[model samples]
Target: MNILILANQDLASNLALNLLLPSLQRHTLRVFLSSRVGKPGALPELKRLRFFEQSLCNEMLFPHLPEPGQRDAQYLSFSQFTPLLTSPVEIVNTINSDESLSRVSALKPDLILSIRYGGILKDPLLAIPKQGVINLHSGLLPDYRGVMATFWAMLNGEREIGTTCHFIEDDSIDTGGVISACRLTVHSERSYLWHVLQLYTGGCELLLDAVERIAYGEKPVARPQSTKGGYFSFPQAEDFTAFSQKGLKLVDEEEMLEFFKHYYY
Candidate 1:
């Protein structure tokens, strides 16, 4: 099966690539890079991206990797994936643009996969793929829908935060039917970034499962997302205060380094 991926260039995207790309030897993979790839937008995003690259450099790649240091391979060998991280994928700036949509249609992909591509796909693009578009949403559907869901989960002081893989539908934020979901317990002791990474790392496995099921002509269960409103946007100041009160650090460098050690090693 030929799978087309639409993704940005952030830790989530990078982590997704680390897991998804190498595991796809059974299928054809082509990537449609999000226009925002490699470009930092807002301040919070900028800071986290910087931290992810610099702090996690020992375990992953960076635009500029630091001076050489002897270290055993963590989880996956970062050296082997240099090609995927450095090489450019075809950029699809607007998923709705006629030219972009036409270009995508020309690919004739069997499946279209999206991981925080930062753009809404129109009906034309949706209909192009034989299997329809699958989105790896940052949060669980019908409940934690929208941006910063993992953060929201932490902010709400919930015990579980997770990633959801769903079938994309027309004209909604994350109204897609659920394909699969995996939840990680919110260890408030863990860094906020560590929790966020679960959305990418664990999420991709769910995505791969959905892909295999669809490829085999098996109908994976698609639970309809709830109509009741629980949509969320970026967090407000008070939310951060709540998060602080819950003893969740905005960024915990050492905790995440240990997290990488345990996850990757």
Candidate 2:
């Protein structure tokens, strides 16, 4: 099977891909990493989130990322793993552009998988893959939808957070038929980033199972979202203040460093 993966260029997405790609050795794979940049005149909160994520990536991930054309390292991060892939990884700014459309059409993908991809895919690109597109969302559907779902869930004081694997049938963000979902206990002691990163472990497993089912000619069951779920945009300053009041940190540097040891070591 020819599979095309669309994901954001960040530590969490990289971690998910690292866990997923190894199990997909039987299929042909191509990856497109999104820059995840917002439009000009974006809100301060959005800018802050972007800055925070970029800072973490720069400090913790970029230093260890393999350089262009440099492949053989004792330990391989997602970027380093590219040299061993059947297709060269692409860093895309406009996923719906004519050039991107043409490139995807050329691949003749059997399926398209999306994980934390920043851009919204249109009909032209969505129509290319025979098996259609499946997305791994960090939050459960019909409840939490949109950006920074884990943060939103934690802010709402939810007892458990979940990851949803669903079919992206249209341009509507995360309002798709549920293929599968897995939940994790919300640990109050953990930072929002920790919960966000942990969600992908189960997220990748669900994605792998969905892909295998589709590849084996079995139709994966997709349950329609029965309720109209609320959508969450980036949290504002007040929301952050409330979160902090509840004793939650946006990030725990020490915990993150410890988590990265698994990939780096």
Candidate 3:
């Protein structure tokens, strides 16, 4: 299977480390990345920065992930992997550009996988893939639609959060029928960042499973979604205050004890 991957900095590294590298063993994989340049943010600059700081702080709340030295960096963006990130990948600032479309046509991919990629897919590019373009979204279907989904899930004090892989029917965000999805247990004790990590780790497996099924001529049935859940954007300061007041934690007592035993003692 020839697969074309579309990703950006955040989830790009996640896809590469979890899915793309493994997929290369069997399929001919190529990547189209949106240069981490001027992507539009839903919030003001100050809010975006605040969210970023909060995200890093959230990471500290979790148990150490046992990444040795440079391996820790691999958990970051493409640059962390360096040469091995050296797949037959192309970087495109804009995915809908004529050049980008020409490149997509050139690859003649069997399937397209999108992960946190911002660029819109249109017309010929959308029509080119044999199996179809599949998006690995961070939120569960019709309920948790739109951007920063896992954050919203935890913010709402919901206990269940998960990943969704849907066949791209149109240009809408996460609206297509679900092909595959896996739910994770989200304890109220856990922070939104923890849920994000859950998606990063579990999401890829679901994607690979879906793609493998596609390879075996098992086209996933499209489960049309309802428009019940409203869309979301970036979080505001008030939202962050709520998140903090809820005492949302990324790691609980037992996990912290385990971290100490493993790393310190």
CA lDDT of every candidate? 0.72, 0.83, 0.66
Number of the top-ranking candidate, with TM-score as the measure: 2
Error of 2 at 38 (Å): 4.2
TM-score of each: 0.81, 0.90, 0.76
Q: Is candidate 2 or 3 superior in lDDT? A: 2
86-138 per-residue lDDT for model 1 (tens digits): 23465567778888887778878889899878677778888888888899987
- Residue 64's lDDT within candidate 1 is 35
Residue 105, model 3: lDDT of 85
Clashes of each: 1, 0, 1
Question: In terms of TM-score, which candidate is stronger, 1 or 3?
Answer: 1
Compared with the true structure, the alpha-carbon lDDT of candidate 1 equals 0.72
Candidate 2's TM-score: 0.90
lDDT-wise, the better of 1 and 2 is: 2
What tens digits encode model 3's per-residue C-alpha lDDT throughout 144-233? 877777778888977888888888878776788888788898877654544565566678887788888889999878788887876886
Model 3 quality (TM-score): 0.76
Which regions of candidate 2 are displaced past 4 Å?
37-52, 58-60, 63-75
- lDDT tens digits, residue span 1-265, model 2: 9999998877788778888888999999889988773442365645555554665664666676656446543334555667556767678979899998998899899999999998888889999999999999899887998878889899999999999999998888888899999999999999888898899889999999999999899979999997688888777778888998999888777886687566444
